[model samples]
Target: MIITKSREEIELMRESALVVSRTLGMLASEIKPGVTTLQLDKLAEEYIREQGAIPGFLGLYDFPNTLCMSPNAQVVHGIPNSTPLQEGDIISIDCGAIKEGFYGDHAYTFPIGEISEETSKLLKVTKESLYVGIEQLRVGNRVGDVGYAIQKYCEDHGYGVVRELVGHGLGKTMHEDPEMPNYGQRGRGKKFVEGMVVAIEPMINQGTKRIKQLKDGWTILTADNKPSAHFEHDVAIIDGKPELLSTFKYIYDALGVTSTEEDKFRSKAYD
Candidate 1:
């Protein structure tokens, strides 16, 4: 069953979501060449604990780390390791936090250093597809609307939309009702309503949509050995509108990048 939150509860959800948002922002400046993803994972674990929240990914599924560090051809669920990320490599860092009995989940694909133009465009298009998906989260739209938006936006740009991994409704638990896929037909699936909150993520690959899992039983990668990008945000339907509980402004701030792309999705004018 779908677990909907009241306006009051949604506010609480925002608090949980922001904890994760701030965590990602903090790591944004620290992500660079020669930095091991395991080191970043340690930093995230400590910070989340300092904020009085637990690492949502840790111990939840017997996962050893707080972050899913997928780099280059890896898509999602990549375990953090001691590997030193070098120039031109992009790592998708997926994070989660449990605060006040609620969970917040968000992700961003970060560059290890100065990357090539082709990979940079892949990152840009994937991030754009994310917002396009979120734009479909408004009240009165179906899950398929969000999926279609993401699929159309990325496929037109020659990216492959991952078929296996998907976004999901989030609240007290990490995964909830309403599986949000990146590819689907319009007007199909569940109808979105007020008080519903979900993570709208697009995992787009630079090659074929097929994926494979490693022997570790956690990491997932593109079967064609091509780079993939993943971006996500936690959102809630507030006052009959879609409101973003998580923001990438901090990430942009750390990377010294400026953007007005999120302006339209901000419920209030962003300062």
Candidate 2:
């Protein structure tokens, strides 16, 4: 069953979500060539604890990391290691946190130093597809609406939308009802309603959509060995519209970038 949140519950969720956003922002400046993902994981664990929130991913499902650090062809669930990131490599950092018994999950793919023009375009289109999907997350819209939007947007640009992994409803737990896939037919699946909060993420691959699992039983990678990009945001339905519970502002601020893309989804100015 889909668990809807009360206003008070939503507020608590927002606080938890912001803690994750702030953590990602703090790590933004630290992501560079020669930096090990294991090192970044340590930083994230310490920071999440400092904010009075527990690291949501640590020991969850017997997994042993604070963040899912996937680089290059890897799609998601990549474990952190001592391997130092190199120039031109892109890494996706998926984070989660728990505060006031609520869970906040967010993710972003970052480029190390500079990347190839081809990879750059893939990143740009993948992120744009994320917003396209988000635009469909309104009251009464079915889950397929969001997935269809994301699929069409990315496929039009000749990108592959990952099929195996999907986003999920989040509140009090990491995964909940209503699996949000990146590709689907319109007017299908569960109908969205007010007070429903979910993590909408688009994991698009540069080549074939087929994926394979590593022997470690954790990391997932593109079948064709092509690069993939993942972007995510937590959202809630309120007053018949979709409202963002997560923001990339912290990441943008740290990188000295500017964007008003999130203004449309926000009900009020971010404090």
Instruction: Report RMSD (Å) for each prediction in the order shown.
Output: 1.2, 0.7
TM-scores, all models, native as reference? 0.97, 0.99
How does candidate 1 score on lDDT? 0.91
What is the per-residue lDDT of model 1 for residues 1-271, given as tens digits with 9 covering 90 to 100? 7899998888778878878888898999998889999999999999999989999999778988899999999999999999999988999999999999999999999988898899999999999999889888877889899999999999999989999899999999999999999999899899999899999889999989999999999999999999999999999987667788888888888889988887777774422
lDDT of 2 by residue, 138-220 (tens): 99899999999999999999999998899999999999999999999999999999999999999999999999999999999
Model 2, CA-based lDDT: 0.95
- In Å, residue 44's CA in model 1 sits off its true spot by 0.5
Candidate 1 lands at a TM-score of 0.97
The reply for model 2, stretches above 4 Å from the true place, is none
Model 1 misplaced stretches (Cα beyond 4 Å)? 268-271
- Residue 151 of model 1, lDDT score: 98
Worst 10 residues of 2 by lDDT: 262-271
By lDDT, the best candidate is: 2
